[model samples]
Target: MVLHAVPPTVPRLLTDRSTSEPDREALVVDGVGALTFGSWQRRATGLAERLRQRRVAPGDRVGLRFGAAEWLDFAVAYVAVQRLGAVAVPVSGDAAPAEVAHALADCAATGLVHGGGAPGWTGGWTHATADGDDDTGDGADLSTSDGLAQILYTSGTTARPKGVAATHANVTYGAGARHRPFRHSRHLLHAFSIGTNAAQVMLMTALLAHPAVVTLPQFTPLRFARAITRWSAGTVFVVPAMAMELLAVADGHDLSSVRLLGSAAAPLPGPVAARLAAAFPNATIVNYYTSTEAAPAQTAMTYDPERPDSVGRPIAGGGLRVTDEDGRPCAPGEIGAVWMRSPAPPRTYVGDTTTSGATFQDGWVRMGDVGYVDDDGFLFLVERDGDLVKTGAHRVSTLQVEAAIHEHPEVADAAVVGLPHEVLGVELAAVIVVSGGAALTPPALRAFLAGRLAPHEIPSLVHVVDKLPRNRGGKVDKRSLRRSLT
Candidate 1:
């Protein structure tokens, strides 16, 4: 298979990097082995040839299910699917069977490529692998910047996951936007699971960023921290949950090698950010906000003491605004719907007209969030639109309550949801996971929040759990929480 010179599409990006820096390390799976650009190109091409033999063609949807430990194979499979101009649909390896089945059936997938001994579906879907037949054969070039490239499902913390489809133009919008995203980093470290938007961003970073991407087979506080020291990683990224865990075990690790620490996939509380600042004394902590439907368009804020609550302004070339019910822009400091825009074409929901109509508009994507902007143009998110708790007379932000809960010394993880209340219409409820050797009760937690929160804002009922239920994106599964609570 030969790739000709083309525009800056996903396939073209891979070809450019491999040809220019074939001997450089492209990917490093800490516990597993590393793969250089040369090896990655050859393996991906061979896999693409094999997939072509299996009758896969352009515009076909191919499912990629590989365990976390199989990052190398997953990378090859993803690039191979792109090389063949097929739409890649990746699901978390640990996703439930039913979830996997839904994605395959919903997309009417043409074939599947799974590794690490993943179970095969019962349906008559053709199966292939990255390590499978490697026959070198000539193939037609069917790739284009406008062609659909991949489909990513939302985390579905509050409802069923929606498939967000993106084209090659959307995926490779910023391929050459900068000389290098992380100037000081030689190795970018993260342990995000496969099939997530975060994981996709990291994959692109491996191909485009200055650093060689490094990841662990699994994510544990100790293991992740140790990888930083062992690899001398200059940049690191994690979600809020992982950041909290890292702080717990940060005492023994020499994390000074890190210059930038980024948190994404969920909100980062003010208190948590303060603690992270002290824990990684030398690192500049930052928070990133974006959704599965919105990529290459995001807001990033390097921690500022003055605007601790802000999620930061839009990066260069991106646009952000808060609008009211009529889709009119709201003034600064006014709470409204959040919308973001990028130069690339926006992604849309697959086969869901109602949702697609509401989400993707003229050139902006509705964030499905409620937030405001400061006079200085920094964005501050109040809550996910669906997470707002509307009681009898007051509207509450779950993010505000959760942020307060995280301030409690005994709290390890917390989630707030509105429960059915016959008289009040809806009542505030909180589910909390206490730190090890710590004991907390409903009354005790409420007492801690007395001065910090208003009466209506405080949770009416609280439950202690060994762990808060979370989806693959490290976000609390509030839909599941409501099911068990009621």
Candidate 2:
């Protein structure tokens, strides 16, 4: 198999002479405006120069807090910072002030840029100063594949968010490898938040590959459909949740131009994938499983109904291993902890070196996901190891119930766990938190779940908790919840 390698510096690859076309639309923000490659480069270079003038030294961390409208500016600023040998940590606009504060403190950011509202820092950016400077220098001081580029925080399900340190080399290499098969002329649509590694990779890949990118400030079914139609985007990247939302409003939209649909963030439930494949018959639905710690290690399933559950196969320069509790490799079809080893995995967790060293063992990094690889090399994700609910006699995967409950329009947020049961050891339980003004009763929820979940899998007890406890990192804290139940 042939392996593709990317240069250590991503900005250099993106701004190369051949890739920089004066008339090509490099980026488009919904209502704000559009920028051609020539415009984007000039603006990015100017921003880079401004940061340099502000005494932003190489390797300094800069925080970006903006909505989808400023995505183009954010991307350009990100590259600009990299060009100046600085790191850009972009936080989601939807994130709470506390969450924003956590990220800023975690990265020890020297400056912050927000679309609106005052941040907790001295230096920041507003809408007025977005296109102020031209700082493109001939040579950009970047990390040599091993040097740290950005610190992406994980979805803190279990605890406070830990910053995953990604190097310029690792990101560039992963982006290049993933985009190698993609044609450069196609317009790409990404529906994820710019703060996520998935979105970052997509943006970088599109830039490096010279693909036109159409972006939205937030993921809305209507907006997404409209953007697809307006941009004539040939490819799109969506999460399973976004895919479901899009499917709900897909009627009356002309999505004939889309050739490929990349789904990530969570496993595309077999039924959901099937529905998507049916809906977008012309497009190939690629189910990708990746993490902030390890870029995209596997492309388990590829829009084929025949093998719906399979995540596909590992990419080059990466390997997957399924092992039992004893550390021995599990036989085909048997569930085990999913461990992966990537040559260019994240080096460390910023500010938290203790847990960082423990995250990777030998060469394999524990993905914290439980699943098994079949004999044919297909990966099936059962659940996250921490999400496994051990009831009296059965071990259930909370992901199964969460998926089933999410299928209900009223149930916006769902978290499942095992609660202490007097007679049945640990009994299946669920804490359902509804969305919008939707009302959920225990009996109604139980009745709704009856046909969807198995007898053993159904929550024996249901609680209409005000809010399921989420850790600092935004992931459901089952351990903390379990402790409260006990």
- Candidate 1 local accuracy as lDDT? 0.85
TM-score of each: 0.95, 0.84
- Candidate 2 TM-score over all chains jointly: 0.84
Q: Where in model 1 is the C-alpha error above 4 Å?
A: 1-7, 128-137
Could you report the Cα RMSD, in angstroms, for every candidate shown?
2.4, 4.3
Best-performing candidate as measured by lDDT: 1
Model 2 Cα lDDT, one tens digit per residue, 1-486: 123354446566556522536667777776677777777777777777766778778878888776667777777777777877888787876677888788887788887755553344543433223654444555454435555677787887656877877777777664444334458336788867767877777777656654677777666889999888887777888877677668767889988878888888777766677677777767888888877776745455686667666677788668988899888999998999988777665456787867766567776778878988888888877788766767767778777777677767676457788787778777877887665577888888888889988888888777777667653223467778888877
TM accuracy, model 1 = 0.95
lDDT of 1 at 423: 97
| lDDT, candidates in the order shown | 0.85, 0.72
